[model samples]
Target: MVVSCGLLTANKERVPLKGIEVEVEVKDHVAVVVYTQHYENKEDKAIEAVFVFPLPGDAAVCHFSAKIGQTEIVAEVKEKQEAREEYDDALSSGQQAFLLEESDQSPDIFSLNVGSLPPGESASIRLEYVTELAVEADSGLRFCLPVVLNPRYQPQGSEGHGVKVTAVPASLVPYSLSFSARVSSPREVLKVDSKCSLEPLQYLNKEKTQAVVKLAAGHKFDRDIELFIYYKNAHQPAAVVEAGKAFATPGTIIGDPVMMLSVYPEFSQEVMSSITTSGEFVFLLDRSGSMDGARISSARDTLLLLLKSLPVGCYFNIYSFGSSFEPIFQNSIEYNETTLEKAQKKVEEMRADMGGTEILKPLNHIYSQPCIPGQPRQSAEGTDGHVTVTYTLAGHSFHDKLSFPLQPTEDTGLTVHRLGARTLIRCLETEKGEEVKKKVVEVSVQSGVSSSFTSFIAVNKTSREAIHGPLLQRRIPGVWSRSCYSLSQQAVVPMMLSHSMAKASRMQSHGMARACSMQSHAMAPAAMLQGNTLGVKAKPESLSVMDKVKHLFRPESKCSDDPVPTPAILKHPDSLLQLVSLQKASGCWELNPALAAALNKTSKELEQPKPPKVNGNVWATVLALVWLHAFKLDAQIEWKLLAQKAVSWLTAQNAPSMTECIMAGNTLLGSNVQKDALGL
Candidate 1:
């Protein structure tokens, strides 16, 4: 995906970023992407334009070059400060220059400076990076190209700064985009799917292991472009060995042959059945203003499911932060009916009204809390950061795994080694010794990977045409739009929020008391109360069945006299969410109207088909499993753990007639799920 930031002339006139062309080549699990951004100066003065964009967090930018007329200047890796000095010197000497650097706060963000472009001049920027494709839950290799970058929030007195973005609505963006991909793998390419329009996949080989696809013509730059590529035997392990740079010094990473290994482990049913029931589960949710709309709603729904899925004997706590933080309880509490209900109620009331994104304080508070004896804490958040494991869900399947090793292969260049070096530099930068810093710089320079201490700089020293006047600085504006997925949407908002918060901090720098007041307001509780209560009490009553039916068929009227309608009708909670909500803390479903509604059946119908000796809970649970396998297979990633809990509960009960229950459930639900599918 191309995050193309358009250019603006020094006088604030449009410099017209002509277009963006993206070419992606996928070899097995790794992708090599090349982006060419075209720009032309239409005005009558020399201007220095800046472009800011984001890449995949883990991508390694191995190449950056600029072509002006017939001259192409390739950048070289150097210390960030040295590169800045060189760029400034080149510009001062009336020569064209280019500088690229990674952001301090986030590795994924990058800034490119095109210095001293004479009027009527045109420049084409060529940037290349390499990243590994993520595995989706449905066993598809997922690739995404983002078009929107939301703001990030920065608190006062923060050390690092955020990007300053002048947003342009997607509809108003004036640039064209072209995207295409060539994918080849040892395994057969089952198919490729996307939410955006795409040309039909074309197989390039008789074995169907190589194919090509492209985004359809006239595509708009609104939502992110997501491509899900499925392959037969996707989980099968494979390796690629990339040959090292021939001319580089031997003994260095660049001169060594690198092997990339991909492994997906499968656990036996016995091991899966032995899931740990003990842990201190701490959930940190972001309630920043950027999270308004579908983003907050999605988070609330995911939080509710997690609360319901917690084991009965475990302990858990809920904390939400924006500028401030609030906990559902004073400390972690044992999971039971009362605690689960209270947490669920509080989660349902969560809103994205917490002014800014100041997460440090809440994170510190959580860490300060005394650890429960023998219960390790697992903290889950709704923001971007380090994660040990990830579970992905496609339309109807789930897969999990992230890291892989690099091997030696001809014509692969040093992409794998550069990526590895980048990873190592990041790890060592977190250390506290001069030796660590030295090693990080060494690896960054040797492997040509941009890092916190290094940057990419190039100058047109051989150009005959010279820039004669003082250059005016210009900032390019990128299209800002809403993301299709809530998670991706969250990623877009924080960059802008961070910019605003940083501006606020600068404005308040002169007055300590004012800064303190702003900070106080940011941290002030939205609905904090004494004792165990953290959120407003649950609604005293729910809508009646008649009211629900009316909600479904209700006509829109602007009249204020009509009672405020409920949030949803028969479609509000959705069948999957409704079924998950009815699950007890013990992991079994209770036979009830809500459960029947989720399954699109009557309570009587669900109860009548159960085997004579099977427990009602067992029958209800079996129906839930059948519905999941038959209808909600695409969301298995979300419900997998919870379903496992139900299976374990059933196994402990030694429930009789499980096969009969499964058969009866299949018949009642019009599904053909087998007993083994439900792990009976």
Candidate 2:
């Protein structure tokens, strides 16, 4: 019998014995799928599981299925090498029957064809796989294997999902990244070396369906290597196909939608060039709390690699953010081996401290600077007449953490104390109170969500660039989506703000509305500074449209469902639950582990001997209802009933606070969800 089995680690995350972690995010026309570390554990033990990938194709829907495969090896052990006996034994059992097939699986997800192949001699098979996005330029992109197995077994009791990275042992760090792996092209075998160099040019024979992998033993048992396959780079080809698919839409609709863009002779190339160049000429850095372990180490390593790759005189800068702001070296710098090597040392010493986020301050610092105009700065080891001009571009900022300010860093210990004292210095301003602009990023990886927030202090005087690309583009993308872009933009905001402040004060102190209207596609600070009035100095744009739209047209949001059906609610329960225990485990002094768990449990207990299975979709329903309110879903239902039912269950749990209890209580109505408890 084929029974469901999976590997579970601490915290209940899953690791399928032999499979890849895949993430899927559905969008309007396309799905942004992320494939992660290919599972590389195999001892020839038999495995049978089914995988299904639903590739939304142009002509029609196409399905790719991967199956379990098995192959046996036969080694002759004869001391006496008699030609006649050797020939007989070799002829009798040279070939072992190889079987490969898929077991049951979800219809939407697919597994590639896994083949049963013996070592040395490779066999050809007609196998199909999903074509995924190209993550790297390395030749390992297009991987083909005779057999494909679903990686990370469905998280035991949980739904099938990608392998959770943080759950794996450190030793099993994914050497390669996997994201949105789909196979439109057919090939066989996975490839990548444990160490450095891979086989030379033309390693892949166009005619051969599979390639033989040879490995020399290192730390593991035998001199063997694991095989992994990925889609090779065919960017130009993929673009053509995608374009064709896009064009095939009704000519009228297509024409109307992209008429202006189509007129640009080189729009596609220009767009692609921008994506590539944005980073080619960037200074992605990080200023989060934990810089210990490999956080700072990994970041330094990446910066070194990035700097070393820059073309001569390519511009860059180095700004550090925390409770206080300063530049490692003030201004946007030019690239050179000498400066690169020197900067590498500075980056390595980065550490974590309990400080507020001044993400916007740093970017503003760079924007405000009077550089060597376009002249590149000399190396950090300057022995010349020019004094190194590192500045303390300090600014006062607000933070939620200020309700309980942390002991300042040695560098900023006195500065924060001074600022706190300054707040009370002016009686009129003290009554005004500080305005807090918290920048947030919501990251959803697999089924989990994580959020990071940084405050933009209203005091107006700091500039520090606070984020960076430490991991590979493919790695930590979830974090990137949630936090990266916002932080990057936030970083730029201060630079633009400060530069505008200088420029406007110098020329004409045009008011804030006009300054805020400065518009640009790409955020090049120098370019943005030229016309910074509209965005920062202009009169406020009509808030009327947004106000009217919100009032008149309310569409049901993505997350919430309407009020729960009467059937889903119950009157009483045997015992109520409270995650006070779970809350304590999280190591925070003040927190509510969310009352949903307790309420869900109580709902089950209320059903008593025959408890109802709370529909997982109901969580989605609750989310939808909350979104509906956000989206202004105007459909009417008895809001009171939902609040009461949910609250009844929530109250039974006896939450620590009314806030927590009310938040949980609102779930039954699936309407009016509060802000704090929701996932980013």
Candidate 3:
């Protein structure tokens, strides 16, 4: 649970939002949260207060209501425009109304309107939402309550104004928050951890299947609250059946029981051992002004790590966008020593100098390029707000469906069904045609989940006596945490996006057409620009595709055997970066002085302990794997794919004395990493 600043009037007057009480229930992987906000108006006139906040992007908001004295009015879903009109009419008629709507641009943002609160009147607003928890790298279920409201940056001439927030220091916030959570699972609850202070967990039974925890008293409305819940045998399959509303209309989803099934499939060791060595990896980086401080720095570091980890013989390119876009190369170039060095240099020099976040043109440009035959396309996006990794298999599209074969409970709530309906509606949002939109609206209304076309509205109709007064409107400001940049990077997994191409014939036949259709979208003519939007002159000497291809394929007159020069920017690289930089494109590290330096050992010492029959490359690779497992387990998510590549390369070698090599490597590094841990 999380809470932040409350309501404010148009004149910057505080609306005396007393406190917030939040209760969370976690059953398996899904969480149901209810927030109750208490607002009191001490002003002489009636006022309307609007509060904007953030929620999990995929959350399903199923219930909203207002309690004023003895009356409780539950909200009903209606069309967005109709709800707005009804609320406005209620306010004009001197009746209290409440409206809650999702933001059009970002699914995570929401605005709640409390209309016509008379002088000396108090109101309690209840908002309940359900969301599935995300699995972290260590198998912990992550639930975050975001209280930070970083200012959103809108491109110049965009449709609506950006969210304006008046943030103060955490200590200066006026409101208090009370929060508690109940967690239950079929397996034992291993533990619960948070960055915020919390009371000791109380187990309800000896099996440790259920527990309750609460936030410590005197919590300031400040940083986002994050909870990581660990369970024994976290990947075990489970299912839950929830009954629908008792009085719901028959034949509808609300009238039927819904089943939520969770599955964790185990793949064969042979299939899991192999990783793709060929692909077209494109990285799109955001350089907007909002990304100025630690965000850009972290982006640069991440880019360096990725560039160092790319496989040999793959096609790669980088694009940076803001008010304008720039490409490192005219076309995608094959990965090699020269190309990798060039990209690394450019990445190190990149800055957040671009004016605005104009991503459409760059995306269009990327889509217009032809896909290389036999190379599946993958795109990774790095942005301050959201990080996305999209995998595009050439000719085939993959869809996942779940099956439930167990009996459903007879008495339960509709939360599970509502969440499922929200998921379906969002999936259909991008499809064309009025029929699709009609389907989305129908599902939204039936499940009581608000969508782009619908909103939740509650009005008090019992009181006919008009309380005449001026209605002042207020927009509550959300607080922005100072440590947002570091916190975001800490939680981010690596941006590696790769897909295996099981069929080369399919990739050659229909890959380009499928890739084009999937990537390209109809763009507004105004945004289809041939130059920068910030009045910067375009480069006149950009190379054509044919010229780039010719240059890429051209033979060098002379080849040098000298080692690749270490970038001056990384003169004193960290242990992790240094070891990563030494890895070859083929996913193996050469036995050299640089590798020894990265491992904090002398070259002579490394060679002295190597097995007599094994080659240097295998020994070096084994040592690197040992080091990674021993020291960087926390970053397993980011390095997992690369490590898989290394393992595949090692397996292909069929090196002798593998167990002896791993033991010697571990002993040399003073770490006890086993062969099985490195997939030997």
Candidate 4:
């Protein structure tokens, strides 16, 4: 039977969450996050609460603990099976136990089972994890706290992991979140910006290396909380040493000071120019139901931009899929004007009506084809679910590295683990060939980085008396997937697609709904249809269901507040001033003698059309413009007035495509702005 925590309580209202408090501390490059959830059983009968949440894919969880009044229980890591058994035993005996485990499918999704709380009792759960902040394409360090866990599409023959997360409207969450972050680094912290409104950054130290930021009051939890942190001399490699716990014995993992190393590898200009200019690019699009709204539109825009940007002699094709798959062209073809036009037409006509999200089949088909010698193959996958499958595909691909298309608190672990020598050797042998085994082993030994598939567990043997009462289980809901469409119109589909999706959804819900070892509540297609299937809360101005569906597909503005959004660089004072300072009286930010030399080019070569590489003048201009767009900065003058000459000069140059200029800007700034939004 399916039990929903969202099911109305005895008073015909949702259960009230006591509170959610998040604390984050950053030391150098690593961030430790702690999430504490307080829950009270106000009802007369005993209750159990299950929370299905999300974390960054690379986060390394190290601690789990629970507290009841003054009694505290600290958990220990064991093998998956062993941990489950102990949790089940504790639950069956009526003693409170909490189980926190990683989902085998997606690294981001996790299920927390807070079991068997007696009537009027309150429990607080604290889970802590550590993760390295990833530097964005724009050189900013990005930190995100996921408020919604979007549903992931599952492939055929895949065993489901974690509880089936029903998508609920955010208003129904019955909880409020309070969060704060403390940041420290060797380099000076320049600024911090967030998608969510934030309180002003408060400096805690005179050196400007330490700061604190908090979420602004009245946040609605409708979207993910994202923070982009900029630092002075960001690319400079640095290391930080954190002293270990004092209570632990010295000379061990718990006692030794942990050092974090950050490195930014630099490549020579000569090496970049040598790479072949022509290659076969394959575009894989996901048209699954989960990809119903903004996701599909984003993919369409991405494809159009990519199609327009292909080199003169490159080859390309498009493959889109749902439950099954299809190819725009039976084989890879040249990316000429006619072919590009044909592919663009097909992409525009594409829809998210392909049934279910099945990616493996098309991937196998693409792999089955013979590769050309000079024309290296590249696959650009566009999807948001089944990330592990994508990882495995990229891991096995010979020519291409995965490019992420788009897109933590706590601490309890005061200890580190032995590098898991055995697991490292096994992973290296299985993933890489024997050729690099010795080198990998040497590095692992020296670096002391822990291996995958190993876990840390803590156990407390103190026991309490058992009480005889009924055991209840409930599945927690998560945020709807970015690709998800309203399920309220399930009956509108053709019978064949309907049947296929029903089967797929049933299988998916079964795998997702499982809480610990308990049976998961299955959601039938009919029931799902009748429910709020849009995966978001209903808005105040209710529109017809059909209108809601149409709104999902509506094209969104690139940037708000303007009919034609200016490039990001035009809005930032530092970047804008840098561009203004680089501009010549001739109305262009020309790569003159001095500027050409800085770019590894001579003034004569800069004027030459296609001088064995990208044109220096256009690139220089784009770089100036791009620099103007990055990060928040203080601007003392009106940039729009000074920007006219450079913009006009740049616009008058017809030699380089806007696509080319954007790509050049991206190369110079390390920013990954999508093609359609380049605003050139």
Model 3 agreement with the true structure over 1-680: per-residue lDDT tens digits: 63334444334577556778889999888899998988888777877877777776668898999999989999999888889999989888878999999877556678889998887989999999988775555667777776655444332343454554455666666567888999999899999999899999999999999999998997776666778999998755555666767788766666676665454323334544433545677777778775565456546655666666666677888888879999899988898878987888898788888877777788789878887887666322331121121223333333333334344555446667777676666655634478877887887888898787789999998745476656776556556654332211111111111110101111111111111111111111111121122111111111211222232234432222334454555443345656776777777889977677667666687789999999999999999999999987755654665687788789889999999999898889899998889977
Ranking by TM-score: 3, 1, 4, 2
Residue 534, model 4, lDDT: 12
**Which of the two, 3 or 4, has more lDDT?**
3
Return whichever of 3 and 4 wins on TM-score.
3
Q: Give the per-residue lDDT of model 2 (tens digit) for 275-353.
A: 2111213343444453333234334433433343333444565555556666565555654545554565565555545
TM-score of each: 0.60, 0.25, 0.61, 0.49
Q: lDDT of each structure?
A: 0.66, 0.26, 0.67, 0.51
Candidate 3 achieves a global lDDT of 0.67
Candidate 1 lDDT over 621-652, as tens digits, reads 88898999998775565577788888888898
Span of 10 residues, lowest total lDDT, candidate 4 = 510-519
**Segments of candidate 1 deviating more than 4 angstroms:** 1-12, 153-162, 265-409, 432-434, 464-468, 482-585, 589-636, 647-680
After the best TM-score superposition of candidate 2, give how far the Cα of residue 45 lies from its true spot, in angstroms: 26
Give the TM-score comparing model 4 with the true structure, all chains together: 0.49
Off by over 4 Å in 4: 1-16, 155-162, 241-259, 265-463, 481-680
lDDT ranking from best candidate downward: 3, 1, 4, 2
Best by lDDT: 3
